[model samples]
Target: MNALTGVLRYLGNYAISSVWRLGYGARLFLLTLLYSGESFKRFQLVLKELYSIGVLSLVIIMVSGLFVGFVLGLQGYNTLEKYGSEQALGILVALSLVRELGPVVTALLFAGRAGTAITAEIGLMKATEQLSAMEMMAVEPVARVVAPRFWAGVISMPLLAALFSTMGVFGGYIVGVVLIGVDEGSFWSQMQSSVDFHEDILNGVIKSFVFAVAVTAIALLEGYDSKPTAEGVSRATTRTVVTSSLMVLFLDFILTSLMFTS
Candidate 1:
């Protein structure tokens, strides 16, 4: 009886805490949006954050994209060859990358790389009382710090996703056409014919943009709400990555279903 009571109590507390955090996160997101005008007013801050969040993430994205494409090419060719439809390998690679893998994988990578960085940086600022100091100096940390990073992430994510898809296509070409001896003309022609701009490319871009908003918002909220201590900062950073990754995947499913449910 005592164990059952304890279990119920724990579950209740967990549910309440989750609700509180969600409400707090929603409030923070609204506040960030409200104060985002400062970010645009001081465009250089957004540019600086773009370099930090976007430019720094390029190496991992490109390398991972290339490898993903290579794997898709090799595996796709093998599978299609069995069915005597290997020429369709190009469309397979292109569709897979453009329609799903590119945005999803890039978002996952961004969450690990840039999302954790945003959380740690802001968490440390909170821990060190820097945000408090800003408040004392009549500066809104949300406007000055959080908003710029938010817009930067919003702008960077789609561009990075596009670059990743482009690199993946190039890698696929190298693997399929050069190494695997698939006809270059057929590969290009099939990819061009089968990949619809509105359906495949545009939808991928939309997914990346939605993922950007979720990831950036979650990272900033985790950092801002973390307890003001070293341990708290560390935990917040971990939560940022885990939560952002999960949110991206969840949103991806919803978006994919809505976009492709024809």
Candidate 2:
């Protein structure tokens, strides 16, 4: 009963606090735009995060994205061939990569890598009383710990999204041209012509930014609330990854619906 009550209370606190923080973040964003200096630190942090989140993770995303695209092309071609629309393989690959698979797969990949790292790192810090030490030193934890990660996510997600889209297309090209015997030039041409780049790319990029924020926020919150014990830190780390990943998936659904509706 105590554990159940604690769980319910945590959920309640999370809901209220999340709503409040979202509003606070929005206000700060607007206020920062009003003052050039307020945004500069975030900008620098963003660049660092881009290196960490986008450049550092490049190889994994490329390898996974390449295979995903290849499989998409192969599977799509097989499916469309039965319906006598084998030529539409280009369109199918482009659509899937842009609309759905790109963000979800990329976010999942990111969560497993950086997401867990952020959680474990923060949890360890908290468990070791380092955060308390910072407090004693008059350092603001939010500015020191949270803002950089949040801004980093916002900055890096779009770059990663672009990576996913471009690499996925390349993967599709390989399968379409080499294995499936389609002309390389024609496959590229068809892909270019079939999709609305502005719609697909912009929507995905925006979604990536949002996913970045979601993942970072959840990770930070888990870290902040982690217990002082090793078990507590471990549990917080696990919960951070699981919760962040699930939230990313859910947010993707809402984002896709909103993007496609208009």
Candidate 3:
């Protein structure tokens, strides 16, 4: 009976802690939103962060997209060839990338690369008392620091996802038509006929945008709330990657269900 009571007490405390964290994260998100308008005045900062988060991330996004599409093309051709549907390779690759893999993989990569960087940078600022010093000077750190990075992540995500899909298509074409002798005309025509711009492509963009907000929010919040120490900064960076990845996957399911359900 005592062990049962202890187990119940532990579960209750865990639930309460989880709720408290959620509420606190929501509060930070709201505060960041409140100061986001200030980013307009600091346009150069936003541009710089855009370059950092978006431009710097391009190489990995493209390379990964290409290779992933290449593999899909190869595997897809093998499977479809067995079923006498090899000409549908283009549609297969296009729908796979645009509808699912593109946004999902890009966001995962973004979280690992840009998300961790955001957390580390902000946590380092906190460790050095930069945010506190800004407060002393009557400056809002959220406006000056967090807001630009947040908005940068938001703006960069969809673009990166698009590029990933485009590259994936190209890679698929190279493998399917150029190498495997699938009819180029059929590949392109079938893909064009099957992929709906509004439904498949637009919904993918929406998914990326939603993932952007969730990832950026978690990254910035973890940094801002981190303990002002090296260990704390490291932990926050790790947490940023883990939490953002999980959030991206979870949000992807919810968005996919809503987008596809009748």
Q: Is candidate 1 or candidate 3 better by TM-score?
A: 1
**lDDT tens readout by residue for model 1, 112-227:** 99999999999999989999999999999999989999999999999999988988888888899999999898998999999999999999999999999999999999999999
Rank order by lDDT, top first?
3, 1, 2
lDDT per residue, candidate 3, 1-262, as tens digits? Answer: 9999999999999999889988988888898899888887879989999999999999999999999999999999999999999999999999999999999999999999999999999999999999999999999999999999999999999999999999999999999999989999999999999999999999999999999999999999999989999999999999999999999999999999999887
Q: In order, what lDDT does every prediction score?
A: 0.93, 0.77, 0.95
Lowest lDDT 10-residue stretch of candidate 1: 163-172
- Model 3's alpha-carbon lDDT is 0.95
RMSD of 1: 0.9
Candidate 2 TM-score versus the reference: 0.82
* 1-262: candidate 2 lDDT, tens digit per residue: 9999999999999999889866765654444334434435557755675677667888887788889988988888888879976777788888888888888888888887777777777789888998899989986555666566666665666677678877888888888778888766666677778788678867777788888777776776677767878999889889878988899999998998889886
Q: Give RMSD (Å) of candidate 2 vs. truth.
A: 4.3
Query: Residue 240 in model 3: shift from native, Å?
Result: 1.2
Model 3 vs. true fold: TM: 0.96
The TM-score, computed over Cα atoms with residue i paired to residue i, of candidate 1 is 0.98
Pairs of colliding residues, candidate 3 = none
Candidate 1 yields a Cα-based lDDT of: 0.93
Q: Write down the TM-score of every candidate.
A: 0.98, 0.82, 0.96
What stretches of model 2 exceed 4 Å from their correct place? 1-39, 42-49
